[model samples]
Target: MLNDLPIRKIIHVDMDAFYASVAQLDNPELRGKAIAVGGGGARGVISAASYEARKFGVKSAMSGRLAIKLCPELIFVKTNFDRYNEISKKVRHIFHDYTDLVEPLSLDEAYLDVTANKKGNPSASLLAQEIRNRISTEVGLTASAGISINKFIAKVASDYNKPNGQKTVNPEEVLQFLEDLDIRKFYGVGKVTAEKMYQKGIFTGQDLKGKSLEYLEDHFGKSGSYYYHVVRGIHNSDVKPNRIRKSLAAERTFSENLSSEIFMLEKLDHITEEVVKRLKKSKVSGKTITLKIKYSDFTLQTRSKTLPYFVSEKSIILETAKDLLFQEKMSNSVRLLGISLSNLNTETSKIKVLEAKEKAVSVQLKFEF
Candidate 1:
């Protein structure tokens, strides 16, 4: 089944602790020290943690106070977006030297399709090493890469080795590699999903592969099919260079919790205006409007309505948001409120769809990269 499919060389490059590393790069005093970027205040949340901080169980999204409890000597630095963006551009410039098929997942990571590269390099593994080396030398930051036949496998392989490392899963080894993979390591499986898979006795890719498609679908709904295919090394999604924006959102976290609906309505108007401004700047409209509420306790709730036609006007969006807001009573005092528009006009058909099962092609035994 694997032999007949078309093969492409894909590399997923992820920077190691980007924000914290960047903070260290510019400040020699911060180097080799436990440092976290952002989350310096009473209500602050850590954005990124350095390797030194990570050793003490400090990590991104953990509260600043808790991070301090874990690593008492942890240093907190303010986020510098301009500096991060400047360095990110330098890294991306290096990527373009190899291939134009670069799809940036964030300022710190991207996927590059090097099947047909400008350098004519056949070995994706070597290309990954060269790219990492360049990043280290030119940008002064380390990176980890995963090289494989498809995006899914490549993404997973990149993490096998962390903090300055690379892993290559050759075409022939794809099956065994995935089968041996821990179920929790699959990219899309989060904590809740991993627990669910464990309860179903799916502990590894091999275990997931054993379940029939119907059995998986019955238990896992739409995601069950995804699990069944990915375990079999059947992911055919292309690396899209021009990925479309799926949604646009604007939100505000209040300094103090607002308990009154009237005050919430005033905040929603401002958020709706920001959303409209962004939508107009992007030249896109959306059919769906979603209202997000985050209570003081940090619990989140979202209400969405998909309209028959697209809308980008502030008045229309505000009206829809108000409707969704009033539809549900407040569960608790709200700390945050947001408005988002999805199902945008910019969405189009995918560049390539997953090939049908019956389709067959000649195998490239060499598997160059």
Candidate 2:
């Protein structure tokens, strides 16, 4: 199984503070100043903060009031997703110039398989440098990249030197690198998992590798096998492109918690419009409509209904979402509302299955070494 894994050249590209940087670029006077791109209200949460704001411990998902208190001079700018999406498109275009196997994790990050690239480049490191330079020159923003033999290591390496930097891990150095890595820094290990690992005497990759496969599986369940192989540098996940998106959602947190069901119905009307517009843009629709609500106390409730056929019409989605909302009893005053569509069209479903099959077959193919 280890011999079956192919050594593909993968590059992970991540934009540095994308929204905040874009805000700075568009407003020259905001450059070098502590700024956050989010709402400036008592109930508002921050979406992104510039590096300058980091000095004062400002961070994303932080309450606007606390962020302001941390950085007294912090400038708050509203999010401009349309503008950010435009820039993201340009960055993706640059990526396709080198390889077709580009998997975008978000508007700001992607994984690219460049082992057999259109550029005929021999070094993934050089390719990363060129890509970063192009982004800086053309988009007026900086990007960081990491190059390695697989997606897992590459994604982790991308953050080694951020905000316009790159790192390359040669195949020979892969194992030693993993052995020295801290468990807390592992790609998928969240805070809770890391705490559990520390309690188990698993502090680094070497410590994780010391455990037997059966022991790992018994302790961590299905995720046990993942940690076992990753610690040994055996991740074989592909950099897949054109994968069908499972769902499309649009949501908003209100400045004030609303008590009236009538007001929620009105809000759902607008949320449905956003979801429908996004569905049309993606040229896809779903049969499942999910209504998500967050109460003033921060508890969340989701209700979903699946239709016999996919529908992207605004009226259909809005009416269906309204039904889902009213069918469930409100536990408290609502502070957030969202709508999403899933159970996608048949064609997309088939495409996804076929892609998975192809990936599995590719992974099973024997490697040269």
Candidate 3:
């Protein structure tokens, strides 16, 4: 039935090593060399690392000190948030030129539903290639795109190529593509789950397809159904223009700006705790959590991460924010702090089953600072 059903074309576009690659494009000297941006002090963590840096085993979230040890000549640069935002806008504008069915996952990645595109190319893969080219030619940054009949397949295809690459997966080829893939390649499967699948002898999609849905649900909980469809190339997920959010956030401006590091931490503790309680009350774990800090100089900086797992614990949420704050390095005095969570989904919602061990729905807690 899926083979005969009318297809909805989708394209997933992602900027490669987004933050670091943007840095390289802006600074010619940094090209082809190991470079990292953001909180680079003794206690700081690498926010973004260039492909060159990755080659030296440097990585984002690695301690700055250790990153330097890996690539002694690594160039550590302070972040230019304004610049990145500017380029993000430009890149988004380019996408809009082709289709309005665009959904931004972040400043760097987006899902474009081109079921009916402006250029009227009809072929999703062709449009994907054109968009990739437009990004490189217009924004001076390389991008990768995956085009397919649905959201899941397109996302998988996009990553098949590296910087400035495009991949297309149609209905017929979808089965083969998935059969060769490992269990961990599915959306929700992480390191721990992958190992569990391996022990269950589900080394590939074919192995996973052999198990019945009932068995998978019995073993993997609510996620069993999700695993079933993915391996069979039967994803029915939509490329939402904008997924509705489950949480709302508000911030108050202080009459007077405060500047004590000790005081800031104390305040953040309460704010983050309150946010966590709200999340639990909703019976949700936000995959995208944002931490906002404003300085006396009228400047603001925020960091966020989307985790593959969900959690509702106060201690875990607060600790993550605390890590980001220290990692970002407070540049000046503080005026305000705000925390918001989005990308929330119901914990017990049913989804496709990929493998026997791959169906547990861990509340996706986006690991953002």
Positional deviation of residue 168's Cα in model 3 after best superposition, in angstroms: 0.9
lDDT of 3 by residue, 1-369 (tens): 466544567789999988898888888989998898864765567889988888999988787889989999999987776688889989889888877667788789898866655676667777778888888898888999988777787887888887678888776777888888777777678888789889888888888989999978888888888888777767766555544556634343444566766776777778877787666655677666677887888698888877687666667667777777777667887777887777777543123222211311222211110
Q: In candidate 2, residue 272 scores what lDDT? A: 83
Alpha carbon lDDT of residue 254, candidate 1? 79
Candidate whose lDDT is highest: 1
- Candidate 2, after superposition: displacement of residue 280 in Å? 2.0
TM-score of each: 0.83, 0.92, 0.69
lDDT digits (tens) for residues 159-268 of candidate 2? 99987898888877788888999998889999999999999999999999899999999999999999999888898887777666898999988888999999988899
Root-mean-square deviation of every model = 4.3, 3.5, 12.6
Clashing pairs in model 1?
Answer: none
How does candidate 1 fare on TM-score?
0.83
| Rank list by lDDT | 1, 2, 3
lDDT of 2 at 353: 36
